[model samples]
Target: MAIELETETADGDDFVVYNHVAPPLSELDMQVIKSVPPGGNWADIPLSIAQKSKRIMQIRKSGGRTTYYGRLRNDLPSYTVSTYFYRPGNGSFVHPEQDRMISVREAARLQSFFDEHRFLGPASSQYKQVGNAVPPLLGRAVGVTIPSGFAVDLFCGAGGLSHGLR
Candidate 1:
């Protein structure tokens, strides 16, 4: 989705704004976006052209493979866009296409984490961190209920809730 900025002539006022309606995704992209499996890969598509076409092999080798789980940002155009995917397992060295899991960066993006957010540790650790994160958007929405005087996070994961509250 795209957003536009508008200004008023009478007051010479500047304010950020948005359209009341959003453009729709292309039908094919919508189909692909809808078909994503929970904890599974696009390869799980039974009749997908990606699965049936011989090009699957080429894409596996060249384009490589990644999962495209939906992101919370789908609901908020002003937020950074992101999505997530899970890998098959913890094994370190699997074929690019057969890796069975999505990368940490991919998972972070799925959670609307910005490209500049630095994740710590190796790939496996990064994936673990991403998997454990709470969507900051959700946290912010929830933070509104906290009392103004003092707030406490209970069983918060990775301080995502705290970060949002602050």
Candidate 2:
């Protein structure tokens, strides 16, 4: 979710600026957020909690890939956004310092959205939009490298590449 930014109007009038609202996280999710450190993951969680968690048990039983509870590093670009980013076990979608999953607005910024680009939808839908979006920075770099005037996007969910070209 987006945070509010205070700003004044150009005509020297008082105005509340950059209105934003983030969905609140649940208590359990908050606990997990506080326990995990930047760039850390489920590995960083206390052994007691980790062992007791159902996700861990399922991972051990299945032997499938389990990088769940991955955290992000503030100093570097984050890992690719995944479709199921709300689930910590899905990808490195946690906030670097905040004890929570990165907000929808934060995810959007990572994908090269300016603060003005407001996402309109329920929290889950907003997340899906951000997760599916191409990183605008990557799109710009690739678009410039490509030697074509006309561009065609087969499944442009959020138009990151199209925005870059524009």
Candidate 3:
């Protein structure tokens, strides 16, 4: 639940090159993100404000998962990290208390990336890098579950699972 950077950064510890910082939100975006609370989702937004969104309107009328526009809960495991974690509309990427999406480093922490592992490139690419790869801890769990057994992983990217198995 807690994370630490491997080294000192220009922005200090909580915020490194790819940590703590979040994208700016539009006025409407701010309203929507603010409406949700810890463990709350799109359904938590007031009807007046929620109806403004074409997608939210559709989901409201028809039906959809509440995962959209969701915030994290301290007592629960984090929702799976996705490539669009920088966008709250994409998933439950919002911070429980802050009115912004989780930062790249936060996503990486959820994905169990090592503190020493640095991601370079634009923030977008950094997010993708964090989301696309399997968590090293998950890989280690899989490896431990079937000790001494041969397994072939198809289309494995980053090979964290394979590496952990070895």
In terms of TM-score, how similar is model 3 to the real structure? Answer: 0.76
Please give the RMSD of candidate 1 to the true structure. 13.6
Instruction: Please list the residue runs of candidate 1 whose C-alpha ends up more than 4 Å from where it truly belongs after superposition.
Output: 1-86, 89-101, 150-166
Cα-based lDDT for every prediction:
0.42, 0.68, 0.80
Each model's TM-score, in the order given? 0.35, 0.68, 0.76
Clashing pairs in 3: none
lDDT of 2 at 103: 70
Q: Write the per-residue lDDT of candidate 2 for residues 25-60, one digit (tens) a residue.
A: 666656666787777766666756656668755665
Candidate No. with top lDDT: 3
Error of 2 at 46 (Å): 1.6
Clashes of 3: 0
After superposition, candidate 2 runs with Cα above 4 Å error: 1-23, 60-67, 148-166
lDDT of 3 by residue, 43-98 (tens): 88899998778988887777778798899987899988888888878889898777
